[model samples]
Target: MLRRSWHHVTRAASGIRWYVHELMGDTAYAKYVARHETLHPGVEPLTERAFWRQRTDEAERAPVARCC
Candidate 1:
């Protein structure tokens, strides 16, 4: 039916959006929040700004090889 096909298309588009968000690190905070909730149920996860700052600081502390 047309409704079923439309549903499938919308689901596929949602999945693609999630994948792109993951690839671009836009969902990092969301993932971090989930992980924090799971691992430390009573603790609060860092805000997005704080999370990015921490990530950047850690990366700077331990640089990785990358093509220039």
Candidate 2:
């Protein structure tokens, strides 16, 4: 038996792995799904300073950090 057949887009990004569809840090999917985007444990595009700002604005994000 399945819990819920929820569908999500997934792929390996620059840093972490197994990111949720809404938290994907890629812009290619941003414009359309931006409204539904959410933050998850995965990569972020820090190639430029502005990229970080735009990403934060897009997702209202805060990185998931570990204590160790």
Candidate 3:
């Protein structure tokens, strides 16, 4: 009984962690890597540093809705 309750708690905690990561954009690179792997099985995904640099460059080139 106690073990089952503990399992439920752990699963809920994991869900919360995933939610927070999604909310903060912390999982963007991970999602990109997964998609890249699926779409281009033989190619390598960009490194975190390179990913951020590319994203920044693209944003600068095509400035979208922003407040600042």
Best by TM-score: 1
Q: Please report the TM-score between candidate 2 and the true structure.
A: 0.21
lDDT of residue 9 for candidate 2:
22
Model 2 residue runs over 4 Å out of place are: 1-47, 61-68
Tens-digit per-residue lDDT, 2-64, candidate 2 = 433222222224223534433665544444244334442354534445656676686756666
TM-score of each: 0.64, 0.21, 0.61
Q: lDDT tens string, model 3, 1-68? A: 99999999999999999899999889889999999999999998999999989988987899578798
Worst 10 residues of 3 by lDDT: 59-68
> Mind sharing the TM-score for model 1?
0.64
lDDT of 1 by residue, 1-68 (tens): 99999999999999999899989899788889999999999997898899999998988999678999
Q: What is candidate 3's TM-score against the reference?
A: 0.61
lDDT of each: 0.93, 0.46, 0.93
User: Which residue pairs in model 1 clash with each other?
Assistant: none
Instruction: Give per-candidate clash totals.
Output: 0, 0, 0
Clash number for model 1? 0
